[model samples]
Target: MALDSLVSNFFWSNSDGSGKIHWAAWKNYRNLKTREVGTGHYIDVFKDPWVPAAKQFRIPVNNDISVNQDMVVADLVQERSWNLQPINRKIDKLYLDLISKIPLTSSPRADKLMWAPARDGTYSVKAGYRAKTSAIEGRTGVTRASPSKKVDTRIWRRCASNPVCPVCGDETESLEHLFLLCNWVKVAWFGYSMGIYISPRNIKNLGFWLEEFQLLNDSDFDYSKAYVASMLWAIWKLRCRMTFEQVEPSPSEAMEMTNRAMKEYWEVNSLFPKAPTFAEPEASYKWRKLQSHTLKLNCDDAFCKKNGKGGIGIVCRDSEGLFIKGWAEQVSAYSAFHTEMLAICKAVQLVEEWGMQSVIIEMDCQDLYKAVTQCSFRHCPWSLHGLLIEITDPVQNRSLVSFSLIPREGNSTADRLAALA
Candidate 1:
């Protein structure tokens, strides 16, 4: 069947036009000339998109044509060969050449429809949309170029009232300045680059800078591209925030936002299997036997910044190292440290509810360890002050309860559970 006919039939049969919005959308999308024919059995030879030179094969208007409206390209083929005598006499040489070059099989099959812009002869919505956009851009004399150039053109044309950088409040806002040269953007890029251990090169051209990273021989080259793209997007968003909302994010906050955005992009776009979480060497940290008659609780927290939520896992084991009871819960939190503090607090509440006289709480966060050991909120961020108070209360009320820090490898089970939760 012809692709358009198939689509039209599907929509017409499935839809009731009670709401005209959906029907209008379907009709608009169906009208887009995005499909080409293969084998040419189902498509109209003169009316449908069958020839490559033009969207449809054009018939000479001055010449008297005797073909039926229902006729297809197959009617022009006989005995597994093109009946080119009549076609050559009717159409121009360019289209005739396109039709003549089409390969024919001894055993013919039904014609198929394929996306014209796709390499694999398969359909892709993205490719079709891009082709449509390119056509529109071509007609307007606007070509795909660097965003900086587009912005500069707009500024020159006085399309924008002000062209200054919103984040830095200095320098004309071009793509280069927004992404790399502005002081605020520079700080964000520096922090992201340092965290990933990839030094920023002193390249000014945005295209060359991006291309250089993409051409690197390192295994993380794609990840590097994602990081750069994320930073660029974050910088744009920061500019928008400043311009529209009149709010500025700190450099650290901007970097964090960029990292979280990159993580989300990877999760949605990744095709490879997820890499295993790295663990410290087993020899570096081993689980120790709990003191006699005391229960040991291993707690861990997994925070997903995209959702502003976290998972907590707490597993209690007897002094002999056998599992007693385990619990996992989801909680709201702003940061990893906050989640860790909440997990510790949950562990304490569980211990107190069980009426365990002597219990040891172990976790994998060194910051949380220091906060508890120092008995001071100096090391804790202000966001965790209230949770820290709640956490310390349970510890102080129970004379035998204590907090300890263990390496992540030693807390593998709890970590796995937290991830699952």
Candidate 2:
């Protein structure tokens, strides 16, 4: 009744009758509270009512104004319950976006979120290694095991304290440092940032580059983000190469790796049901055989498996297998195959620069070849055809241009050279 000074141990105090309510009153209380109470005993709060005179809160018989059991304090408390609706509202939308991006809904997207220990009192990291000897393939998604623990390390640097770049140790080892700041990485980043196919010569600070990254527009953001992610992934991969795999990728090799990664992610994600492939269905083109003195420059471009770095390889071989000349040029660009076709047009400029005459130019890229060979056509990136024609117009009469597909294997040498580019 006295709310402020209500004894918490009143039930225990009433055990020997030193409290406000008694044991005999409990039965009456229980009977009164019984209908409203859903389950469980409610009279455990009180014990005995026979104690010394110093402890009596009330006399039992005469003052019975009968307390209402319905108003019992504990009975007034509601059951604690959980509703998943609000949680679902927040998570369901996020999950839908996630599933839309990553269709395989079951895979764990976050490393820290899904990690669990094994039954053997050890982490699954060890269990995954042991699974290699079991009747199961260890690395696939079916194995229910992750890649080796070393692969999941957060900090990749050897010098963690006051750390500097591994490539050029002049700057601190951080994301911006390793990516946009370090001399070695900055050059490659700049090569991607600038329109140069070649990496930059020097990188002094990351702050300077961060400014550039912040200033990039939406299109530039996509390009720069892909470039940065690819380059970072490549750097991590190259570190794995040297540390775990005992193989190291050269700067150029690493740059190419970055290109391939970005390209692959784009192409693979583009193929999704929701995200339709942006590439046009390539049209076919007819080729006209040209004279030997008039070199047919068959230029093919390939983006690597990761980044979209442009590699253009040109084969100037005659009708015979005897090699005339080949040129492989690596361009730092995030554009897709159509841009590769544009690079071929750029290669025509290179050919003209070499002072070659009566050229029969060919490409494995059908859409680009068709667009270049024809005067009128409609295609996505339709404006490019005009640029293609304009680039080739000078040599159209003096030289002929054609497009055809050689087997991918036959094109290997050129492909390899292009990949190197």
Candidate 3:
């Protein structure tokens, strides 16, 4: 196709249509490409295809008064950088973000046309088929309602640009580097109990390693396939935040989102099994008595449904039922479980601060009691993981801590204090 003279000038000729029936189909795809700018001197600003971050490898027209069609890319270049003064108010915010991401070259060279779909700029028939298939079915396996009008933007960015890992400044971003090797991902993996340590040498490749981990879901292991899917989705969301919204990447935020994703999957799955969901479990109304030498600490959360505010109350008493120390305050919380967790952490902090040797922690929330006492936090709510980690950390050896569940009536003193706060 490159050796024919008529086909060489076929894309740019607008006046010739006699032999354009098949040529137009080729020209339509030819426009869906980009050129690597060298000096930015010859490329047309709007007419020519550039900016692979946008649709069709070109910028979209926005409804603005400062539209300029008679300009080249050189008009917006100053001191080897993009001069936003000429086009800041001329484009939409979404398109402006895409334009700013396009890197500029300082050294003088010829403008090179690039095939944006392939990893390398040069095109092949195999790459064309993969690109067309990705357009129909998404690269990340998300189901789309309308494939033609809506695009899988995450896959689009992956194809258009070669970017480094934003969380860790790695030189290259591959599947191995993105999921397994990055330091930020290591911290996230540690969020689960005992953690997963991946040994690359023992496995053949990434596929074999993931398949081995996935098979453990059906075994007696606590780790499940839902967590694997959640991790992949969370990592993709982190990349999207940096790519589209320009938000800073956060490891804690990523873990929280992963927990939320797993929770959503469990909730939907529970519907089929007909598992009963309850605000509080049916428990014995009696309160267990503590040892005469031990101190008892009671904590409760008073959450306001209207304003989403919460009151935390902590009361400590001796085995004789004599009040020793009481703390109450109003604070902001994400959910009722989160508020209860925050109060528990505060109670533990008070125990450590007071130098109490032996104490029994009591609460009205049965779900949290089981989560804390059983040493299993994999199925906890989204925001409670961090607090659970904190509560589980300081109690390793300093204080003898035992969790107990009580009815709302038995813990009325702490409940009243929480309401008063």
lDDT of every model, 2 decimals: 0.69, 0.47, 0.69
- lDDT for 263 in candidate 3 is 85
lDDT of 2 at 353: 80
- Candidate with the greatest TM-score versus the true structure: 1
Clashing pairs in 1: none
lDDT of 1 at 267: 80
Provide TM-scores for the models.
0.37, 0.29, 0.34
Model 2 misplacement above 4 A = 1-292, 304-306, 383-386, 397-410
What global local distance difference test value does model 3 have?
0.69
True-vs-predicted CA distance for residue 104, candidate 1, Å: 76
- What are the per-residue Cα lDDT tens digits for candidate 1 across 60-80? 332465655676777778887
| Cα distance off (Å), candidate 2, residue 386 | 5.5
Query: RMSD (Cα, Å) of candidate 2?
Result: 32.1
Task: Kindly list the per-residue Cα lDDT of model 2 for residues 277-348, writing each as its tens digit.
Answer: 598855534334555565666666777535445687877766554578888876543345544665576667
